[model samples]
Target chain A: GDSVTQKEGLVTLTEGLPVMLNCTYQTIYSNAFLFWYVHYLNESPRLLLKSSTDNKRTEHQGFHATLHKSSSSFHLQKSSAQLSDSALYYCALSDRYGSSGNKLIFGIGTLLSVKP
Target chain B: EAAVTQSPRNKVTVTGGNVTLSCRQTNSHNYMYWYRQDTGHGLRLIHYSYGAGNLQIGDVPDGYKATRTTQEDFFLLLELASPSQTSLYFCASSSNSQNTLYFGAGTRLSVL
Candidate 1:
């Protein structure tokens, strides 16, 4: 069984500040893909970043996440938070050995609020 | 611009009523999935299909039935809707089991 965990339920920050959303996972597959998805107020959730290679950092939309297999963590980070960065962030994990389809196991999500 | 469309943006149904949520993807993806988002559970997989006429039970498929009639169409059915089933439903499609998913805008279903 695969599972993902997002420690922060909510994080509030001021505009132009640094941001980090913790994400961790537990999986038995050797080739596991970790993903970060951002969901806006009225839009569908979209992929922000993903990584399968351990210790490699993936970056997109001013956000970065590094997959640390040793720790089973793929935490999302941003150098500077923008007002538009406010949204619900989800961390997911998928393995290459699923019998049916590539099903994602998601965390409880962290709501990011960037204020002016 | 991956296109995944879900019908009936908002739906209201009574307990024990029948409800169907339709999803269509123009991406020609080989996999489609149904997930429900709730306050504390995040997104839980309900059902998924690998191809036309193929169905697979997901993590939470006890109260849901799904059908994939074509490569582009996937349907989720709730034969007896319950108040516990009220949540935001999302439809997603991917080229394969190990690819990024494109999601629809989502459907808000309320079972009273």
Candidate 2:
């Protein structure tokens, strides 16, 4: 069975500060895909970034996440956090190559609070 | 932009009642999924469909039923709703394996 973990339940940061949300996973499949999703209040979560290549950084909307197979982690990072970046972030894993229809296993989610 | 819409933005039903959550995607995505969000469990897959007339059990499929009538529509049914079923429900659609998912505004369901 595959599982994802996001240790931080909430992270508060001031605007313009650096940000990082830790995500780790445990799985048996090779060449797994990792994903980042953001959700606002009362809204469904949307894909923000995705990657499978280990050590390759994927970036979008000023945020970046590099999948590290060695560490079994795909932590999301931002050079500068903004107020608009406040939302719930989830880390997901999938074994698309295994004929599982790419079923996803998501983390508990990290609530990011960026303040001015 | 890809659009996935869900009906009945909010619902309140009594215990042991029937509840249905409808979802539609205009992007002709082959994969559709249903997930439930709770305070502790961020989100867990309830059921999914690969294509029209295809259904699959997910991580948690105990108290739910699903139907895929057409390529564009997927419905989740809760025949014997319990207080534990009170949570936010989300529907998402994806085109293929390992593709991005577009989610609809979640529906808030409260079982009293």
Highest TM-score among the candidates is held by which one?
1
Residues B1-112, candidate 2: write the lDDT tens digits. 8899998999999999999999999988899999999876898999999999999998889999999999999999999999999999999988774467789998999999
Residue lDDT tens for model 2, A13-114: 999999999999998977888999999887678989999898998999999999999989999999999999999999999877435376788999999999
The parts of candidate 1 lying over 4 Å away from their true place are A97-100
How would you encode candidate 1's per-residue C-alpha lDDT over B1-112 as one tens digit per residue? 7999999999999999999999999998999999999988899999999899999999999889999999999999999999999999999998864478899999999999
**Model 2 clashing residue pairs (backbone):** none
Residue A29 of model 2 has an lDDT of: 79
> Candidate 1 at B58: error in angstroms?
0.2
Q: Which stretches in model 2 have alpha-carbon errors above 4 Å?
A: A97-100
TM-score for the first chain in candidate 2 comes to 0.95
